[model samples]
Target: MQIMDVLAKLGGESGFALFFMQGGWKNLVMIIIAFVLLYLGIVKKFEPLLLVGIAFGCLLTNLSYFLGHGENALYHPEIWANFLDPQNTAAYHSYGYIMKNAGLLDFFYIGVKAGIYPSLIFMGVGAMTDFGPLLARPKSLLLGAAAQLGVFVAFFGAVLLGFTGPQAASIGIIGGADGPTAIFLTTKLAPELLGPIAIAAYSYMALIPMIQPPIMKALTNDKMRVVKMEQAREVSKTEKIVFPMVVATFVILLLPSTAPLIGCLMLGNLFKECGVTERLSDTVQNALMNIVTIFLATSVGATMVADNFLKLDTIKIVVLGLIAFAISTVGGLLGGIVMYKTSGGEINPLIGSAGVSAVPMAARVSQDVGRKYNKNNYLLMHAMGPNVAGVIGSAIAAGFLLSVFG
Candidate 1:
């Protein structure tokens, strides 16, 4: 009798027994999804730096749910739900309850909820970026602005599909092809959609090499792709130092909501260009960026609770995000084609495809495509103009959306 009692107790506590209880099937499904994401990040090397952490966070969060009835659970969506409820004044806009009752992942999530991680990531991006190409050719700004056509297009599409205004705005920003900007905007406008939006945004960004080439080919003829342009005039160090200050002041004054992202971005760039803060620039580029990326990716993934992520809305968001991203690429290419025609074939239309803010990746694609047509053609520096411009343009688009909906 004693032996049988011990065996029964063990069986009751086993994961096998628990697997059949408490909607464990949903957890199982989520665990499978986590494994797939892990495969993509590890084996396929798809944004491995962030996707790997995100996959692990998803795995940990789902596994913790198996012991959710006890204190062993690492995250609790109920706590966040209460925090988002304005009517629940005791829980709303306060972290006191969270501090007392939260778990490990919940603590990490604080940075994401408070909008710290993405803004800091922008600082790192600014520190690493070179704006000489942009200042050399201001026409690239128009290409970057044209790429934002997809942002508003996606916005209207989401609205027609039944999302609320804030939700639609969050969906629209994914078209910017900028992961940090998408996260920053979504957290403010639609935190509930953060998981899907972040996932979709980063996934599409990783697939830029595949998604952009087809669009580039379809939009332009070989002659336009092979066109070579004259070199831009040299930019002085004084101009480089002054550009960030002027941009930050003008943009922030025009759109006060843009202060956090724009201010941090310009500060990082200043640190790089001013030549007086090498150490600060280095830290922001390497240490600070890597640390925040881990925290941000994991915390964003923690929100992918089975109940929230495995829904029809997620499917819709994924489709809409793809459409938005694709359209943005098309818009940029069209802008390049226009420049080619207007410049009398002096500018390569392929450079316009780099205007989606994927940084050097999109610009490199332009170079590759241009080289295929004319071995002597060099579009990298030219493409960098629009590539960097896309960064500023996307931030501005996020600011505009926030002003309207946030």
Candidate 2:
């Protein structure tokens, strides 16, 4: 068969054919990546729920053009049939035009493109979060602040690696270990890098247990790791009710740009804390959070088309993401050490992992590490103090970057 004839059988000449010729090789690469994400999420239980859905979502948009399904389709049944009849190519072109004119994810992606998904998520976070631990142990806030060292370090690293200032800022926020914060910053500063940054942030967050144990063990001795921390005092209900509002007002007053994330986050917490608002809080935390998570994950995953996501820059993002994670880990450990020294060695260093702001993941890792050294020590509660603080600290860092660069 002639080369041109062979090419014709693959998909027939047109934009789809050109797309295959241009992006087909990379499409296979992304499929392999999706399978890996699926395997990691499934067998390993690494963010199983999210990565599974997101992996399939990534594969969907990528495999679409190959099916001759046009730009966006929930279902596309024309694969071999488009090639068997050349007349159909022209016929489908007319249909594809109609679909394009109809508009699909173009609007959906706008929500992502404009930085709306993460803000909505922060609202849900406020509703679900328990600020009692943070309020009871304000010093843990320092650990959260220390964890952000990695963000600035990674920003510089990205710049050194040839990314522009705003792009580097977007990439570095991944080190904050805050997925929504990373997305929020990226959509504003470097939307082009959003797909890889979001995926990498969430992936590393899910991998926290695997990544942190060795680092914690390497930095801590048996006695220090085993050091028992005092249980946190039960926080007052009044304090919980007021904390989010105070923080939100503080952030909004000082840094209005940060209010989008902080305001929604605090408002959710307000509902959670307010005794009269259980029904509202429950809806915001459980129903609303889950729904937004589905939309956010699938929509973000849709952006991972092979042409956009499989560039040389994707490799750089992956590498930079690893750097961000590693640096954040180190920063957490250092914060633990600093706090331990400040308190004359009373503070357990494991709490430093919570500084990365992966919500409970890093905190859980701290608890596990403490348990390894002493079977009964429950550092999870204590680690939570720093864990939540990291969220605020990262937000502030994001704000700083925005203020300086925006």
Each candidate structure's count of clashing pairs: 0, 3
Where is model 1 more than 4 Å wrong at Cα?
1-16, 66-70
Score every model by TM-score.
0.96, 0.86
Best by TM-score: 1
User: Local error of candidate 1 at 54, Å?
Assistant: 0.9
The residue-by-residue lDDT of candidate 2 on 63-148, one tens digit each, is: 66443345455322232124224576553434443334432443355455556778878888878778788898898888898888
Candidate 2's C-alpha runs over 4 A off are 1-20, 66-103
Model 2 CA lDDT for position 64: 60
- Candidate closest to the true structure, highest lDDT: 1
TM-score of candidate 2 versus the correct structure, residues matched by position:
0.86
Cα lDDT tens digits, model 1, 1-406, are: 9999999998987656767887778888988999999999999998998899888888888888663553566878888888989999999978998888798999999999888999999999999999999999999999999888788899999999999999999999999988999999999999999888999998988998998999999999877877888999899999999999999999999998888899999999999999999999999999999999999999888888888898998998999998998899999999988988898888888888899998888899999988988999888999999999999899999999999999
Model 2 residue 50 distance off true place after TM-score fit, in angstroms: 2.7
